[model samples]
Each structure stands twice: as structure tokens, then as C-alpha cells.
Target: MDLQLKDLKGIGPQMLHILRNNGIWKPYDLLLNIPKSYEDFSITSIEKWHHKETITCLGHITSELKLIRGYKKDRVHFQAKIYNHTIDIIVFGRNYLIKEFKKNDCVLIKGTYDLYKNSIVASTISRQDKQIEIKPHYRIEGIHDLKLTHIMKDLFESQTLPIYENLPKELLDERKLMSRREAFYQLHLPQTFEAIDEAKRRLKYEEAFFMHLNMKKDEKIETRAPKPYDIHQVRALIEKIPYTLTLDQKEAVNDIFRDFKKPFTFERLIQGDVGSGKTMVALLAAYAIVTAKEQVAVMAPTELLARQHYQYFKTYLKDVNIALLTRKTKDKDMMKHMIFSHQYDIVIGTHALIEEDVLFKQLGLVVIDEQHKFGVSTREKLIEKGKHKDVLYLTATPIPRTLAMLTYGYAKISLMKEKPKRREAILTKYITKQTIDDMYSMMHSALIRKEHIFLVVPAITSDKVTDNIETVYQEIIQEFPHAPIFMLHGKLSSDDQDRMMENFITTPGSILLSTTMIEVGIDIPTATLIGIYAAENFGLAQLHQLRGRVGRGNLASFCYLISTKEDVERLDMLVQSDDGFKLAEFDLIERGPGDFIGHLQSGYLDFKYLDILEDEEIFLTAKEDLEKIMNQPDFNSNPKYRYLYKTYTKQT
Candidate 1:
């Protein structure tokens, strides 16, 4: 069972290298490598095949597989007879398997039916007679699902691994759940769709149960008592402001206050779209904590954003002692001393705030802006600087439900749906080569109006960010020669970036061309135009964030998507709605939770079987069961709950 992957037959050096690259080290890992999805490759007759649709058919090779020299690489071209009809077979990247296909050999060919070419673009051609039933599909990049399936076939045929049931037998009987061993195997190789569903249900239950236990893992921590501050002071600061708070903003603030009044630590996420007045809500929350004589640490993802927060706080909370801490802080030691001495009421900075040298005297609240940018452990590290302090996470990117379920499992949630009344929606549109002239004319008018412009390009010459800004700079300069064009990219140093950004901000009618570096917290009120070239290359949340760069000011703004990918689902969703959260939900439905979190979220929720959105009932049941196990002392000895709890702890 613990044998290296090389023990499997037919897995030569190339296959072993591919498997190792994908993190598969041993035969036992095969059982743990659960399939994310299943594709139906059941052999079907050609009569029911649709054009351009994937179809699998049992066929006999009609001609010897011949290797033809392609312009780029050698190609394998063959003909197969299916249902007494001959069809061309084009096999790509599998020329090594040409020896396996003979003129009369029966094979199962699976791929899309190319009606125009009268061929089947072979995604996989299996010579084995065993029909590839509902085939397991791995979400791996280095190898195709069919090849992985074949590898698994060899591993199972060896029959050296002895699987064990992980779940307690009594609980399985009580819940009518499948055995863990059976569930694991069924996930990879199921006989029917119902079997897969049953297997998934069992795995999801265990995953959700463990997740609930992890959610309550912090219950053992000693929490600081809630300190209520006078609302009058906070109200005074709010009153000093020029405009009224929206209803949503008021509700979110009330929610935070309500959490602050609780005996337990307040961990709430104030999720909202860009320009949704979330900063003001966070400001009021910070003010209350400061009034309570507790220090606050506000963390941003980047120095630019940290400086923006520092400036924003200095303007609004003039009386509070606030310090900006970063790598280049003039008096770094002094700031750390002041923070440790409780002289600074509020400290806003980047990762510098979490440095070992930086200590808080009585850190009461941790305010993390753009929470997604930092890893979950990074947030934990910051919060640990003080005793179990209340946490306030601000994210302009809407929380996808899967993330909301996993990361926000135990935290209180407040949604800020409304932007301030003064901010106008940015008019977003997609442009093709034909409509590019109209877009240029529009940019010309915006420049003439004295407004600034932002142009983001996915410029790549050879590699290594070769003139990303310069390549686009040439064309943009030609279009608006009168306006000063500035370039910003990752290659620039911090000082250089600051200088360039300052120049662009101060100089009206100027343009800034760069990458997604300005994706978040770049405030330019006068900048009314943002052009995103190759918009299809970005994710939906990113495009939404880039689009948010505009429409910050009172004036109506425009976002030009310079791509012809109109049929792209994410692009269509972007065009349909200006709501960031809506786009996030759509992305979650399209790409799933893993794509949204990447590898930043690591823990029990580093998910394998979390269909949190679809299995909400299972999660609720797990939560209810968790309360029983936590409260009952007798359950500690009961093998079912006791062993399962042990399993949960072992994972953590």
C-alpha cells in the first residue's frame, strides 16, 4: 500500500515524473486522490451522436495507425469503424501509443465528434476491452483524466493496499451512511450515479462534521471581556462627516456594535462591493474600540493601501493617536515602542504590523482590509498579537458562499449591499476591433473633459514582463498625444511607483497604463476612464476590482473591455451586473471555491468534499451534532463521537 508509484506497471519514468509533479507519491495516495467529477464515456451508437458533442463508441481500427509529420509536432492519424461506419480519428499528444493500435484491434474511442472534418478528435483511445463506464475525472493539469484512470487501473489490479474504515461503525449504522472505505473507493470507481451520490453524501458528512469541530477549536481560548464605549462619541464623529450614512451602512454598523457587546470575541466580516461605504463602517467600529482605551491594528495587503488607510483615518479620526508602520517608517523603533506603550490608539500598516518587533499593549480589535489578499494564517498571526481580540475583516470582493461556509463558519457576517448615493455606476462595455474606433473617440472626449484615464494591458513580448507598459504605451500615446501618459508596473520600485502615481493623480487628463497592480485601493476620484485590454485573462472578481478603479468620483465613468471574448461567461456576467458580490456568486457557481481561495486558505477546510453550497443541510446537521459533542462529557468515552473527535483533532 505504501509502495512508490513506480511499482505500478507501465508507469515508466515519464509517467512517474508526471505523477510526482502532481503530488502523488505512493499507491495509497490513489485512494486519497478523490475524483472531483465523473464523465460518462459509456459506449454509444453513432446514430445518436451530435455534432461537436463528446461521444464514446466501441470501434475497430480500419487502418494501420500512421504517424504523420505535423508542422509543430508529429501527429497520429487513423481510421476506426463504429456501427459499420468509418470515421477519421485524430489522436493528439499520444503518438507514443501508436504501436498499440492495429488495423483490426477493437478499441474504445472517446472525444468530440467533428462533423465538419468527419472525424473524432480522440481525447483518449483505450485498447482494453473493459468499457470505461462513468469515468472518474481528476482536476489535474499535468495529465489527462483518461491517463490517470489508466494508472488507477494498474494500481487496483496489483491489489496490495489494504483499506480501512475511518468512520465508526455505530455512527454509520445510525446515520445510514456508507463505510468510509467503501465511500473512498466508490468516489473513484462507482457502478452507478446513485452510488456516487451515496459516496459523496457520506464523505461530505464526515468533512462537514470535521469542519464544525474546527470551527469550535477556538472555544478553548480565553477571551477578553467586551468593553462597551459611549455611542455619543462615535455619533459625534459621524455627525462631523459631510453626508448621511446609507441604510445598509447603518445596519452593518449596528451589527458590529451588537457583536462588540457580546461576551465572546467578535469576529465579523463586513463584505461589500467597491465604493459601498464599508470603510466608514470600519472607521466607526475602530472609533468605538479606541474610545474604550484599546489599541487597534489595521492591516492592508500593500504599502500603497496602508498609506491610503492611514490618510483616510487621519482625516476622519483626527483626535485618535494613529501611526502608519511600514518598512520605510522613519522611526520604526519609536513607532513599535509607542504601539507597545499604548500611546498609539490605532496602528495602520501592511505586514509590518505583524512583525515580531511590533507588539500591542492592549490590542482590542484587529481590522484586516482586503482579507482575501492575505492568507488565513496571516490573519490569525495578527490577531494573536493581542489576547483574543475582536476581528473586523473588510473585503470589497464579495464572499463566495463556499468560502462563507468554510472560512466564515463561526464568524458573524454583515453584508453592505448599497453604495453611497453620490457615487455613480460605471458604464461597462465590451469592444471588438470594429468598435475600437468608437472607444478611442470616447477616450478622446473624456480627456478633453480633463478627466484622467487608466489603461491595463496583458502585454508580453517574449517573456519576463518585456515592456508590458511600453508596448501599450506606444499605441495609447498615439491615440491621446496631448494627455501625459504615465506607466506603472511591478518592475518599478516603491518610491518610483509612488512618484508615478502622484504625478498621475495630480496631473488631470493624464493616463496610467499598467497591469493588475492597481486592482485594489487605488483611489483616483478624477479618473473616469479605465481600459482593460485582454480582459478575458483576468478572473471575474479581478475584473470587477479593476472596473471599480473608475466610478469612484461623482462624475459618471466608463470601463472599456478591449477583448472580443463576448461569449465568455464571466465577461457576459460582468456586462450584466455592476454588483461585485453577484459576480462572485456567479464565479463560485462556475469555477467552484478552490479557484477563488487558491491555496491561501489552508486548514481542515482545505477542502476535498465541500459542496457547501449544495449541501447546506449536511453542514447544518453537522453544526447541530457538534454542539451535542461539545456539551456532553459522556460523549468523550463513547467510541463513535470519541473516535470521530480524535480524527478531527488529528487532522488539525
Candidate 2:
């Protein structure tokens, strides 16, 4: 049999199961499990040993080894005399070591030295001849260190590693990169630090290179027949709005129009901060499609957001036949027939819009709100419902310019950085737990003025509670006994959630306690105050989104970040600025690209080593290399590139 992981000498059935659980089912997988860190086992003099530092000392066990019985177990203790110093050695779990070592026996002891006890807690004791120059430390769980080291050593000495060189020869030569076999060997067992560093660089480049290739494959430019639309009708709809369009909004609308004029199907991303009128841009695009006699579908991630868009569309496009389709729609069959029969010019809904049976009459434009919340496959499924429909992705979570260039490099992008002319800037403040009484007093004043409030928490129930909704809900109701307070969370039934939201919207001076479910979609103009509990627990982008729930109207709005003094430095960034794009850049820098873009979208990229935020140079280099490679005539025909493409596709 081929030497698989199970073929290893000590790997029994239970051991094989544990190895597979850590993604090491094959020998190659085990080889790829590079060391998380390394320990230098070079012998050090006892006089040079530092406290809390792991060191190996060549010494003689001058005193007799004794087994000391403690409350837990027998501990083997001995005193070692080294060059000018006497060091005590203690072994906690190895009583047999007492008989293994005798007085005046020279041995090598490796462990961490303690200053308080003037002793070393021995992790491993070996003959001086077996001392190593450097030891690699792995991150595998539920495995003995010595056993893993022995297995790895055996594999390295006996087995031949799989050699798969994917990079072009010229590029490899120019970059001075090592071949795949050499890189793997050096990564697992390097003679010097330079070798390990070079190996890491090669691996990081491969990660970035493959990621770019996968993204390029997914971003194939399609040549779809253009659908002619009247530009004057779109302009007329824009003019009908009560407020004039900002320059950014006008530019964004013009960009969409330009995209519609192209012969290819448009894939565009429209990003705007809160209250920046992204809905207006979407509405204008819908109007253009409707004017062209083509149907439009706008999908939001949640029902509340879908309803919000439905209301906005109905208010603006009164003559256009628009309908809402959701999981809870009263007449599902009728709604499906109406959508399929072209009874509606525009349809807006949640994921229900992408159902296999929810066919579109003619889906010309597909607008996805909070696009990061949904996976790429979900977006593709909805667009597939239409025949080469132009996709307009709407995101309130502002992305940094660098990130947008790298992640959405293949797509047309438009920005709505400017807010409406009348929208007021929200005042953000960071307060501590002691200041709650004062904040409640202010809330009472706001309530008396007929303004609604939102208390956002991190969790729903008190069991797994950190910034819990139930706890805050009880406190708020007790503080203001006569005030109408309601609780909303993901655990609640859809009907109950909708009722709570409706009640909060219809009732003035109402307080609603909710989780971050209200972070994106639902908007109430009367919601003048937002108190976020454990604000430091939220990302800046999320806090920005929660703050956006208010300040939708001309009313003066306030967002209180309830946190401790320790979190002041981080939360101060939110208090100082309202620009979502700026905050997004900061968030990216502070929390990394995965946390900023969210897991759903980041999982699509699936980069192993390159960080989109920190490894910009590597990413750019890889992109350039990919572009050069794609220009080659044999790029697609090459077996290496094909393999990489196939592997990435399967993983994603």
C-alpha cells in the first residue's frame, strides 16, 4: 500500500481519527502542517540562563534523585551542578525518571527556568548526545510533543515529498523563489532562519497567486445583448424626488446608466455610508429598467429591510406596479403567479425571491442590499433567475479604497460618500456603566418629546449573555414603568419579531431592546436615541450601522456607546467620526479584512496566508503575475494552472 497517514507505525484507528479531525488525513497534509513556532535547544551555561526562558543545560546530577510525593502525584526531583551554579530540576508527571537518572550522571535537561524557586521544571530529559540545535513546535491538539516529533522525523527521513511546481520558470527565476520540494523541506526542517523565511515567502506567494486566479476565473466578463432604455425617463424619475441629488449620487446614477449602455451584462457595486441615499441610486436604476419594459428584482437580506425598500419604491414609483414577496406573504401562489405573469414591474423581497419556483417575468436588474450578508452563490442564484441581468450590489458597510480595488477589482464600482442635504450628523458619545442614570434621564426627556429609542445588545438570552437583551429589557422596563418597551431578537418567531418592530414603529415614545439584527435594515425617523450596550464588543463598521438606524430624519440624533474606560481608545474612533468609509478603513486596519468584510464574503476568497489588509504588496505582486500569466498563450492549457483552478473551485 502507498504510505498514507494510517501506514505510519504508531497511528492506530483512534490516532488516525484524531489526525483526520485536524485535517491531516494524508501524509502530504501532515507535511503541510508547518510549525507555529520553534524552540532553540542549543545548550546554554547555567550562569547565562534567564528566568522564564526555556534553555538546555549540560550538567551533572551531583545529588541523588529522589521521588517526592505530593497531594496529586509523585514528583521526581534532583539537583544539578552546572558551570558555576547549582540548579534544581523537578519533573511533575514522570516518577520513573527518578530511577532513570543517578548521582554524577551527565545529562541534558531542557525546560523553562524559574527565578522564584531557582529551579527548572523539566519538560524533557535526554542523554547529552541527543541534544538538538533547534526544535519545531506544532499546533496539533491531543498529541504528545515527543511522539509528533518522532513521526515527523521518520517521515522526513524515509518518504519522498510530492513535488508540484506551479509557477512559471521565468517568474520563479526572476523572483529567486525555491522550488516546491525545497520550500516544503525547508519549511519543515530549516538549517537557518534565512531558509525558513524564504520558504514562507514562497508559500505566501503561492497562496496569493492562487487566490487571484480563482477570483479572475469567477469574474469572467460576459457579452450579453444590451437592452436599450430611455435615459430621459430615468432623469424624469430622479427629478420627481423632493430633494436634489448630491454630486456623488448624480455621478453614481450616471455610472449605472453608462453600465446599462454597455453591450455586456453589468456587475457593479454601489457603496455608500449611512444616510447617503443609496436607495435613490437603486430606485433610479429600477426606474430605468422598468422604463425599458423589463422587470426588476431587489433582494434584501432580511424581511424588515425588504419591507423598507418596498415602501421606498412604492412612495417614489407610484405608477409602477411593485409587489413584495416574502416567506410570510399571505397568498404565495398568487404572488408567484403575479411575479411570473408580469403583473409587477418591480418585486422586492428577502431570500424568498431566489426560490426555484420564484421565476421572474424579465429580471433586467437585480439589486442586492447588504450584499456582504449573502454569499456569492446566493447572489448568483438570484441573477441566474434572470437571463444575464445587470447586478447592482448595494452595501452600507463602506469598504476602503484599497480593499475595493483588490477584492472588487473586476467589477465596476460607484461611491455615494455624501449624505443628503437635510440629514443631520449624529452625536456619538462613549459612557461608562456609572453614567447610565444620566443617560436614562436624557432618554426620559427624549421620550417626553415623543421620540423613539433603541437599546441594542450583543445577545438575546441571559444564559450566554454578554451585553444581554433580556437583562437590559428588564432594567429598562423597571426604570421607566409607564414607558412602552419591547424585546426583539433572532430567537423570536418571525411573526412576533414583525409585530414587535411594527409596534415600535407605530407607537411613539417607545423603547425597543434588540440585538444587532437592526444593524442594517429597519429605519425609523422618530428613533432619535440609540444606546448600544457593550459597544466595544462591536466592530466600528457595525457600530456605524447601528448608529445609522437613527439620524434618518431631520431630527437631532444621539448614539451612546456604553463601555468601560479601557475601551475608550477604540470607541473614541466612533465618537470622533461619522464617515463610514473612513471608519471602514480604520476597521480594516484594526480588525483585518475578514472581520471588516464579514465571514460570508471573506470565505469566498479563502486565502490561507495572505492578509488582504497587511499583505498588500504580496497581493499586488501576485495580481501582476497573474495578469502576466493569463496573457500567455498556454495559460489555460498548462496542467499546473488547470490543477490550481480546479482545486480552488472545488474548495470554494
- For residues 1-652, could you state the per-residue lDDT of candidate 2 as single tens digits? 5668878767888879988898888888887788888776777775777889887888889899989989987789999987757989998889888778899888888888998898999897876556656667786778765567777777777765456788767767888888877887776766777788888888888887776777776675678777788888877777788989999999998899888888988788898888898998999989999988899999998888899999999999999999999988898999899999999999999999889999988889999998878877888789899886888888887886547755554667898889887988899988988888868987999899999999999887666445697678778878999999988998899989988999989999989999988888777888899999988778998899999999889999899999754888889999999988888888888887666666534423565555666677877787788788678787667775686546545754
Query: Compared with the true structure, what per-residue lDDT tens digits does model 1 show for residues 1-652?
Result: 3577777776789877877787778877767888878887777676779999999888888998889888887779999888888999988777886877689999888998988888998888887657767988788876777777776666666566767665556557877899886786677767788989999898888888767776777543455576777789988998998889999999999999987887878788888888888888999999999988898999999888899889989999888899999877997998899999999999999988889889999998999998878876688789899886888888887865446646655667788888889888888888865688877888888888889899887763436443356667777778777789888887789889878888888898888887788988998888898888878767788889999998888998998887756655568778879888888877777777778756445454556776656787877776776676667786667765666667556744
Error of 2 at 118 (Å): 8.7
Runs in model 1 with CA error above 4 Å? 1-196, 218-220, 375-381, 405-412, 460-467, 564-570, 588-595, 604-608, 611-621, 631-640, 648-652
Q: Who wins the TM-score comparison? A: 2
- Give the total clashing residue pairs for model 1: 0
- Give residue 127's error in model 2 in angstroms: 2.6
TM-score of each: 0.72, 0.75
Which candidate number has the best lDDT?
Answer: 2
Worst 10 residues of 1 by lDDT: 459-468
How far residue 569's Cα lies from its native spot in candidate 2, in Å, is: 6.9
Looking at model 2, the pairs that clash are none
